[model samples]
Target chain A: MRSASIAECGHEESNAVKETQLLDIHDLVVHFLREEQVVKAVDGVDLRVKPGESVGLVGESGSGKTVLSRSIARLMANAVIDKMSGQVVFQNTDLLSLSERELERRRRKSFLSMVFQDPLGYLNPTKRVGRQVAEALPPELSRRSRRHRVAELFTQVGLPGDKASLRLYPHEFSGGMRQRVLIAMALASRPRLLIADEPTTALDVTVQVQVLNTLERLHREQDMALLVITHDLALVAELCDRVYVMYAGQIVESGDVETVLSSPHHPYTQGLIASMPGQRRRMNKVDGLVGSVPNLALLPSGCRFRSRCPHAFDRCEEMPPLMPTSTGSTSRCWLSEPEAEGEDPS
Target chain B: MSTRPDQSATAEGVSIAGAPPPLAAKEVSVVYRTRGDFGRRTARHALNRTSIEVNYGELVALVGESGSGKSTLSKVLLDLASPSAGEVAYHGKALNTLTRTEMRAYRNEVQVVFQDPAASLNPRQRIWKCLASVLELRGVRSQLELNEEITKLLTGVGLNPAESFARRFPHELSGGQQQRVAIARALAMKPRIVIADEPLSALDVSVQAQVLDLMIDHQKRTNAGYLLVTHDLNVVRAVADRVVVMYLGSVVEMGDAEQIFERPQHPYTRALLSSRLSIDASKRRIRDRPILTGDVPSTTAIPSGCAYHPRCPIAVERCSIDAPEPRVTGDGSSVACHLAE
Candidate 1:
């Protein structure tokens, strides 16, 4: 559905990408109707991805990272999307402003593509791997060229791309190989931006490392912008240049990975880092964050995270904006009032 | 059926190690019966001569990737399934040799908390009934006594405002809350040993940490030996006293957690450690030593010699023809790889 009119847009569409930024999302608000209750999945999210930039969207479950990313391409399938009001500008054009047919063309011809957590679900078990990957190619390509292009894409993503290898079914491939197939399929269109949502979470540790390496290679060689949405801060720390920490549907903090990871400004960010299990020399006895994520339907007013914040005070009766911190980071907490520079909190 | 309890029923008095391990597997091997194409039954060796012990007061982690037979070993110990070729014992009594009454007591003394809490908990039952039923099976008759015990069990796992949670059904609770209920039910047995299989994997990071801490607290208070079965090395580092690394249905390395983690000797163990995502960003490296290639072999057709030979980075000619025997090194570490020597 998102590819039909891309071919019809003709010659002028070839030079349409005049924007400096690869993708820009402004004040995005996405709400879902669940059992008659409004679920503010994403509220007033602002983010940008420049060409060749690698950014990490760090959040736990229910932080709306997935919804926020999906909304960029209007890719929410079979969901009760009640209210979606936002501008997803891609390459000098507002994608939201395009007509239904134009939006479909814009999405298919525009700057973004997505890779999901589950590889098995996306790939058809009964179909040949080569045919499955070729489905993502443009309709203008010859049948033989599509098959040949798929094999090339498979090799690009580090899959065994021999003729015989491409003929095997999805079931014959290992979990890591299945993910590689998905990556190859995702790369077929060669979009400027690739949104990978927990692409390595289900894989084994060894397999995860392999996939991360593949993603890094693509980011550097392909010159493609990457918006990696995941809960694994370690991967973000390793791969991404910039990081955004989200909590309860809003981005609470955003900064360079080192600055954000090393000295997190928001309490939620600190708690998330503390929650992750590292290689302990001795058995660690530290206390983790006290409670679970609040229900999206019954989310507290004022500050969404106030109920869980340890430093939450009376001032938290009102929402906090994404204000600048002294360490060149952005934080959404009243307590993070840009303490004096050169003062090491660690 | 009336029976006199053993003098060892006073589990609280057994302070620490040196006694016989509460749960022990002696050269246990398990073969599963599966039907292949053409209705031909095939026997697959899930566990082969795997010997493990869960000592009192120490948390031992059984770490392995998928298809490494870690789950098979856990099931064998739990007696949820029988081993095709070895013996599983509970407090020195072989599982097959135990009398019906003794076996029932053994079942209560060794409880297991599974990966999925929702599945472990009965969906039709209320939280209160779940705990109450466990207590009732242990011979708690009075309604008042049952309620008090249930509240304590729930509170022990930090499911507070116990009254509210007690009345709520399983579906009403979140994943974390449901897991807490599962842990509460498991704790109701007052087990001498707890086998938690990937308990924290399903949860979010914040919830995972809290649940891990709760399990640690329970282990300390009860001094029960814990067998934490998981693929996450970080979880093992956080709580486990000892570590056992498995690959392709065999123990590749077993030692003190510090020794295994700080200086892993076996190639398989080293690869596992290097593959882990460390929190320290400065040393965040992708291409490290011992980065193994290839996935684990199929259970039905395991590699002839050392199952790891195909993927081992430093495999020698000997590795392909002869499997290494378990060798005990100084400092109490055990490894079953020729290269480690």
Candidate 2:
């Protein structure tokens, strides 16, 4: 076990250029084995989260956004990994290649952590909040010191001083407080990258705003790399620096938040953005698109979105690679490609 | 059976008694019995003298978070759950004395589209069978006639090629499709009133919009009254013509949707609207809005005077001592706040 905390080592990785991409993933694939065949949950995904940036991985319920983030977090107990061939280069170390031990040793403590959706269920019910946070600290720390640090960690995450409140069981606290404790646990290691998977979904709207504001403050102060996985576009538009619209386990579009949200390049992205109630105010009710994501086990032959695509054509029969479109944004749509001879269905 | 609108007949038949105007509920309250390890108490005071009325062909939204009694009031209207106090009338008829057959007829007139489409639909049955089961119970004769009506209903809800969709099972379809099927099934009965309880809350954001639009469009075509129950203020803003704000089983505020949005008289209504994610960056700051203190009080232990006084930001001494009666605000909005007056 590594005795030293990365913060104590004074690693300069935190000082990496803000403009430079902190993590870049290309052609990332994650497959699950069923009885009959392999389910390609994340077939080919390209994702990039820059330093001091918050990016959103958005899709419907079964969309591969969760799987992709879990793969990076290395928390894929359910994933029957047929392959995860992709570059998840962070601080020049390929996360995919690192062994369990190397990954643990090189774990970007204080640099990478995750706050899951279910705050109450995430922490062990029987465990005290202080002890749960203490588990994230270095094992070398004595019981007394760990206890002291736990109180400080709780305070840092907006818990009250002395944390006599945290000394109570997990069930004792309210949902919002439990979520704050989860954030406290995530920050205990001082991770540079934070992968929050729908952290505020279960919370009330008032608490959701409170937690979101806290995240925004953390992202600004620590310059942390944040990848928010959520189904809410409104939340993404509010918080994320850039947005990646995922469909059928693959990123269909990725760009600046304003550009993508305002003028989406891909049809899927456009439908999703427009389908939101704020965007559709009785002019023409397209109801977004009419279909769900295709089954991963028996995915469509060509562009996965073609089945639901309003602009799908004959050319969509062949897979459309992620290409820089004429609209000055990246989109994996045959329609976006200028020279493509696909007939316009519209 | 007349297709044309008989305005006088419709008005006379649907209008509320005493008021001689439209349907009215005067102080409807519902209390449930609950027994815990400690002792016997109230399980939930689901509805607290929540007086609301939907005029003929008008869409009204009863909006509140869980335990606020939106669902309870919905049940009260359906007479599935009877109110402990106050009265619910249809036109001039009191509902509690209705025979089973009369209640069934009332149900045929008023239908509900639940929030969970999957749970509402029979998973074991095909989509057509689900619709067929209802039609069969209603005794609609002729297979060809029934089939035509089903297809028309499906098409009306934006499901093209109803035949193909009808053949599929509930699980085979998407969430949006399942909801469309549910809506079609509801319309198959040709109900005069539709009480949609959080219909779009379970759906994806984009899909929710589509469902809302469909519901709104159908209401326009049919001119049926809607009792929309939802926790989302945004949805109410988009679709509802009138808004009813419920708090701790009480109708805290009620008004035209625009009036409620522009000047929310009730503290609960104000908090809900303010808590909504505002696109305006300056208003997005959390502290600018007054956060409601404490969780909703247990229905059994509802406050002595005003149910909301415990959590109301501007609760006065009178607010805690005596419950404020609903009064028409100067702004033409009905508010049940002591401070509002």
Candidate 3:
């Protein structure tokens, strides 16, 4: 079955080889203005997603992965942004250059849609769940058709699409059901690219598996590109084809999911893999990185992870560029540099 | 429930061999009664006859999903909520039988670390003041001694250059730092038993590992019994000496962590283990594991017989009519399933 899926993926990729990337991001920088300090949430970063490909963006809380994703959807609040630069190209169009009205129109046109972590916060508590999903549909549809489309979308997301269930309020649903409702709303736009940010973090393990299965099925059946942003390595391994590891507002590593997870080159990536509780047996101490994430406003001059990195040296005083490794993966660490005068640590 | 002598002996060897455990809940149940429409009375069985014991120097993990009665069980064990049936005991002494002075000592010996540090810690108080209040209750009154103890606590939790951290309020510190302070506060009393409820769920994975290491290191140093209540199975597999699996107000399985992970007997245990997403690429494809069909049934209207029958993949007609009593297997693990041998 796995080999068959791989063959299918290869066939799909070849068919879309001549097409432009589904989404392309270049040197994107976003800084949040906090009183006297500028929090460099997302420093210079580049990422891309091919058509119908699933990409995973992995990071910790303050690693700027969220900021990077929000910037792509033009979801960041303009009031707090001190500086924003770089181009977010979606479907050969510079989304960054588009006005608010145009972006709204584009969003309504099913170009792209995003699902956030908190399901309850996005849904209207007072409005019927069915009507909320219907609102995401195009305004041209008749009321009867909109209701039918909402039910179909609900069924697609594995939720009860019956009239009785549709009339229920947001509070009446479980956490997993509520998340499925949000996913139904995202799918209502019939978007080509779906961006789900920590979609299953708030759910239980069993419920998470159910939701993941739904997502995988939808992605395969609809031929939609998916960008999953989460802190879970296991989630990435299970759902994404390729992954980009973000740390301190930079892409520390990017490669095929199997390759990066199995044999990571960046020290930060290695640390993350090592810290997973599943890697060790009962009572064995996990070798977690020493310090907390750096303060964004007062980030270290050189490598931001140097403070917590065990192998930090004088060379680390200068930031290392994201360089290609022997395994066809990119890593931003001096240790992975081709000409470095030392044995490869990974 | 007939007990075979050899099996009972093995069970006694694994647990309850010598002195009494630090904390134990014996057949505890909690039922919340509320008035419904038309002045009708309704009783929700939040916890149903659950028994758990945490021995000194051991880590016991209570694993379950939301509304599975894990939190209700924790509340009962902490003596914060009185059990509708059964009892909570400390060192074999029932909580209700203890004198006022003994109860005060019991309160001092049991410390709790909550899930969210921001909500748990006093926002208005500085870090030192939080630890100081706990110390003051322990009868350390002098200014110089309090400061020294505060510094020591901060250093113990890896907040080095402790003096600087001691002056900051809870809001000033990061999530990890605030959690460290909370851990420091919990450890200040030098309690024999610590109850941490979803302690690492709020933080990132890296910070989670750090906080878990701190907890494990402290448990080793102090030989304190730890009852860790959480939903993450991976964390439980890493540190728990014993595991208790709860579903819809009842414990379906309880056994040694290794045995439970490697050879889970109960169907619910098997499903939960299979559902866990591992960081192995070879297992990437969604294989045909026994994925449960639906959500956990409501506690207010629990299933007639086996609470899990509705979602159990291999459930039989008997499962819907008769609730299986917990039976000990040859491996000394207890499973509440008729099919478990």
What class would a CAPRI assessor give candidate 3's docking?
Answer: medium
Please give the CA lDDT of all the candidate structures. Answer: 0.84, 0.77, 0.88
Q: How many Å off is the CA of A110 in candidate 3?
A: 2.1
After superposition, candidate 1 runs with Cα above 4 Å error: A1-19, A77-79, A107-110, A339-346, B1-19, B37-41, B287-290
Error of 3 at B271 (Å): 1.3
The Cα error of candidate 2 at residue A28, in Å, is: 1.0
Can you tell me which runs of candidate 2 are displaced by over 4 Å?
Answer: A1-19, A104-110, A161-164, A280-287, A325-328, A334-346, B1-25, B35-42, B278-313, B316-318
Q: In every candidate, how many clashes are there?
A: 0, 12, 0
Two-way lDDT contest, 1 vs 2, winner: 1
Tens digit of per-residue lDDT, candidate 2, span B196-225: 888987887767877888888878788888
Q: Write the per-residue lDDT of candidate 3 for residues A203-256, one digit (tens) a residue.
A: 888988999889888888998899999999999998999999999999999999
Models ranked on lDDT: 3, 1, 2
What DockQ do you compute for every candidate structure? 0.56, 0.41, 0.57
Cα lDDT tens digits, model 3, B1-341, are 01111222222223456645657888889999987647788888899898889888889999999889998888888898999999887666778877677677778888999899999999999998999999999999999999999999999999989999999999999898899999999999998899999999999889899999999999988899999999989899989999999999999999999999999999999989988888887864653334677888778889988999999978999999999899999999999998998
Write down the lDDT that model 1 would get.
0.84
Put down candidate 1 lDDT per residue, A163-195, tens digits, no spaces. Answer: 999999988889998999999988988978899
Q: Which of candidates 1 and 2 reaches a greater DockQ?
A: 1
Q: For candidate 2, write residues A111-226 as lDDT tens digits.
A: 67889999987889998888888898878889888888888878776677476776788877778779988998898787778899999888766667667877877777777778
